[model samples]
Target: MATNITWHPNLTYQERSELINQKGATIWLTGLSASGKSTIACALEQLLLKEKVTAYRLDGDNIRFGLNKDLGFSEKDRVENIRRIAEVSKLFADSCSIAVTSFISPYREDRDKARELHLNSNLKFIEVFVDVPLEVAEKRDPKGLYKKAREGVIKDFTGISAPYEAPIKPEIHIRTDLLSVEESALQIYNYLKEHNVL
Candidate 1:
């Protein structure tokens, strides 16, 4: 005999939201490789921690080296990469955790698809565009990814061989070229404060 699945309604999101003293959300940072997305994300997480908030960061390099090791930079692989991260972010948000994900996520369609997976009123999926000119990003090649892509050593890289479509209207746009790391973090924190998420 097959066992029937049981249904159970445990704690409500409102209960959890009240307990945390804040709402659940995911900060999605999308930009070129050297556009300072990760830097700002890390800084923001530290600031949140100081304010007694729980924050988790998922960096592109860290994820690519592990969760997406088998994946290449092809369009399909890029979709899969962002899809996995989005699902993970949704899980974190559902658990009332602040999830910050830094990725290129070059395609608008792919990013929107990811957002659809967690289309909840409580889930504030903020898309932060780290705006840095291509020339500036190339100059700040901390990992030399730009040079490699230009030399054809790395194929399908965003903002180089591949395209990186900036968000038409991002929830937050941090101009990395103009703002210092601390300033960018403050901008993000102010946004969170304005939304009453922190």
Candidate 2:
């Protein structure tokens, strides 16, 4: 921690939303590898943008290339990565833009911490569990991560080596195998509409 550190107050969330005609929230998509988190997130962002809603995607691999470059897949590093993501998503929500985050955030504790951060800030934290069976995920492994994990080439892989703590009561539980990408995005969009996230 730094000495003499203090938070400078800025425009209120309501004020910003009034000016921008948009209220911000975070739709956090969590699941195992190949569970369609990123794909659904991408579709949701596109749909929101087309409807004139300000939205941005914070992809796991993309964030690792930049904002979280120093972080690795270790348990400690993963925790820190989520902490940073929570902070960044809060900033976006405060700026009156939806933060669509796609990550295989396997730990319940870390996800709960992120939810707490948004709750404290008076922002919406929509937990979307893109759930798929382990066998289904392995079959759909676009990155071959499941195969690598099975071969012992990848360590600490969720649903393979590491554990994925499924959400007990996620706001949205999407079954990608049952729904198309468009339908999945529509489901989230409908949730936002119903919850008055506009």
Candidate 3:
């Protein structure tokens, strides 16, 4: 048997934004692990919350352990992982929440597919690249992921065994190597305000 679902064409994003007193946007934070994407995202969330803005975070590690547990690091699996996250973020945006997603998402095509899936013409998909050298990421190795990758214990590790395609024209590129967590978050927050997403 198949389940039937009802669809309702309700208010638009603009309408919802007006009612919420804030704009809706998908802040896609992409970079290697330990590149400070999640750190900055968390800080940004706190700042937004202080200002009473609705916000939600979609973390990659947390997601992989659940919704994408069956998936691997293969190209196809990676794409699917991001696809699911993007759809989830779109739902959050529809609820007038600022959806912030932090993922390695090394492939440009995978990231582009997310933009297509959401179908929001005015959807602010801010690509915040956590610019950090591969050596630095390995040195920091907050989770020992890099150590495992280097020892061949981990496969498809971005910037080690896997490829990471840097965005040529990301909306905002924050160098974690240079900016403190608070500074990076502030810069992103300011960008959201400039684009009317907060």
TM-score for model 3? 0.92
TM-score of 2: 0.98
Q: Which model, 1 or 2, shows the larger TM-score?
A: 2
Top-down TM-score ranking: 2, 3, 1
lDDT tens digits by residue: candidate 3, 58-150: 896678888889999899899889888988888887777899899999998888877766654556677888889988888899899999998
Superposed model 3: Cα runs more than 4 Å off: 1-6, 119-121
Lowest summed lDDT window (length 10), candidate 1: 114-123
- Model 2, span 40-149: residue lDDT tens: 99999999999999999998767999999999999999999999999999999989899999999889999999999999999999999999988999999999999999
Q: What is the lDDT for 19 in model 3?
A: 85
Each prediction's TM-score against the native?
0.91, 0.98, 0.92
Q: Candidate 2: minimum summed lDDT over ten consecutive residues — where?
A: 1-10
lDDT (10s digit) by residue, model 1, range 1-198: 458877687877679878877677899999888999999999999998898888899986678889889998788888899899999898788778789999989999888977777785447798999999999999989989899999999988888789988899899999999999999989999999998887
For each candidate in the order shown, give its overall lDDT on alpha carbons.
0.88, 0.94, 0.86
